[model samples]
Target: MNDSLPGYAERLDALHQALAADFRAIIARLPWREHESILDPGCGDGFFTGLLAERLPRGVAVGLDTSTAFLEAAEARLAEQIEAGRVRLVEGNVDRLPFDDATIDGVFSAHSMQSYPDLPHALREFRRVLRAGSTLAILETDNVHSIMLSWPPDLELAVRQAEHREIGDEDSYIGTYFPRFAPRLLAEAGFTDLQREYIFIERQPPVGEALERYVELYLKYLAEQTSGRLDAAATARLAEIGDPRSKRFLPRQANFFFGSLQTLITARA
Candidate 1:
């Protein structure tokens, strides 16, 4: 339980692999054009930013992260793009972007804003940097609990409620209120033509062995995150339910759907 959480970057790399398809699909929905300059706020490993650069050939993708370590890794991961002048890695904050007003053509943040201390302030900054009519796409999930599991709806709700109290609104756990909250925040930030799409990848839900591996990986991290906050029996119960062979899995799937809302939202600046 005392282990440091600095190793989280490795966990994110695993996540990128698991959700790569969904990532690509979400990016495809954006209104893309040649030479469009994009900002990837909180671009951890720059994998997505590199992908963005690859897809946009002539376009530029500036990846911003708080960690110099992550930025170095990004620089290495995006070597080709950087060489081609399509990628730039910056160590910066979302609430206070480094670019001048109305400088960037578009802003794309994926599962990153949850880490921002002030969501409204970050949105406002994003609005400031983006040119008039430029697009801003944000993809995040607050329903990470009981997803890819077979447990009762009540059990899922219970877990979600607990996590909500523990990890109020952080990168590891942002609760389900975003479905309602993000729109209001965007509207108030002067972003118009707000379009949101609730993306639940039911067509390719990780099942069998894949589901088992993901559940194990996520549960281990969750156990550490909630260490002293969770009772022994509660922690044990999570392990039991996460097991693919557990009897509760099927019933849980029946009680609730087999997917979570990995939503993608877009707004015009």
Candidate 2:
């Protein structure tokens, strides 16, 4: 009964691989304990859950996701780790975690809140299960809110026009204001003592020569994905934004990405 996209598990694994370094930095900061239980709601494919197991030698990590496809992927990937009593998988939704109130010692979720039907309700559920004085950690990309593309004067409007993304929608509130908005939500749900950190990957030419190539191809990619969104003038503008051959293109000193930002927020429960 898993309703996940056909290749979601595979795609998720690939993404985790690409994000391995950032993931390690985020996981390394957890105040691990020998006898603690951690809940990872919406854990996809167990790549991170296995990393958690490696970090928390004596602790138990439980991962929950609605997709049986993902659970199976986790099981297959973490077979030895799961057998050693380090990790467990459950099939459920974060909106209604399958656990008693105030039972979980810690909770961590990533890239999952944006899809929740009722975000505040889900936050309440997260707080309900978390033990008082424990930790709640979230890692997400704040592209919708904070990260602006260096090319466009109005990146938000451009995205809206191109992809039909709505203003003040999930893409607006969580995507834009996220971890920035998280502290307030956590406070309302009775959490305090907040900490926010970010791992940024600048998509600049000097970061690598491939970035120049990436930038150059971006215009064509954009045009393919969204045909009429860019007119002739916009095409010329995009070339200036992305084409390394253009005189107006960015020099090596500018450390900027096209339109992406990744962030991690940790707070007390």
Candidate 3:
């Protein structure tokens, strides 16, 4: 967790609530069997980790993350499953998994790869921990079509270009470029049977409370990330859209709608 982002946990929980349905849909797409051990890397609040446990009646779901705060929250959220031995939470990093080799039957990660400093190393670790023919599924943001705020084309482009330069292109938009590069990366890491799927979630007014809060917080986070990089007018516009008190608050607009695209890539180890 970034110390600067005080609301990181809150934002993650809100996002889980808002995208619950879409996330469940993506989980359903994973090739899970009833009695197979599954690993969920970067299982932030254990939202999807609990879901994965439910899918495996006899098997266990191991949720791993580097953040102790996140692991603590996951522990509480998944206490029942943990007590039942259906779930376990571990504090660890993706690039260096703690599990033994060829143990996990399947691995599922959601929107977590972008944070990793060395994605190739993490992918190799994922491959190392999986048994032969096990499946690995990852969900990443498609920044190009994600969080469309209805901004003018030029301003949007300018903001993106500036943000990319400010935060390195790979770190800023890994999801947008994943499809183009993931195939080779996975192949080199000893994964095969590569597949890709796109998941879309859109909301129109009157949006639910969860979606409304999610959009507001997400915009604010983006605004903060691209803070001094934008021109004065663009900065003010971003602040206004993210500010719930402002008349131009995006979610409250009469025609307000939100859409997101996430890419799900799966491979066999």
State, as a TM-score between 0 and 1, how close model 3 is to the true structure. 0.90
Model 2 ranges off by over 4 Å? 2-12, 145-165, 169-172, 202-228, 231-260
lDDT of model 3, residue 53: 89
Per-residue lDDT of model 3, residues 1-269, tens digit only: 45222367677788789888778877876788978999999898899899898889999999998878778888989999999999999988887899999999999988777677888888999999999998999887765666765655776787787666744565555534666678988999899999988777787788778877887887778778888888999887777777878888888888787777888899999
Ordered from best to worst TM-score, the candidate numbers read 3, 1, 2
Residue runs of model 3 more than 4 Å from their true location after superposition: 1-7, 151-155, 167-176
Quality of model 1 by C-alpha lDDT: 0.73
Residues forming the 10-long window of minimal summed lDDT in candidate 2: 5-14
Cα error, residue 260 of model 3, in Å, equals 0.9
- How does residue 28 of candidate 3 score in lDDT? 73
Report the number of clashing residue pairs per model.
1, 1, 0
Superposing all C-alpha atoms, what RMSD in Å does each candidate have to the true structure?
Answer: 4.6, 5.0, 2.6
Candidate 3, lDDT over the whole model: 0.82
The candidate 3 region of ten consecutive residues with least summed lDDT is 1-10
Query: Where is model 1 more than 4 Å wrong at Cα?
Result: 1-5, 144-148, 152-158, 166-176, 203-213, 228-231, 240-258
lDDT of 2 by residue, 79-129 (tens): 987898989899898677899999998888877777676777788898899
Model 2 per-residue lDDT at 256: 53
If scored against the real structure, what TM-score would every candidate get?
Answer: 0.80, 0.74, 0.90
Error of 3 at 187 (Å): 0.3
Q: Please give the range of 10 consecutive residues that has the lowest summed lDDT in model 1.
A: 168-177
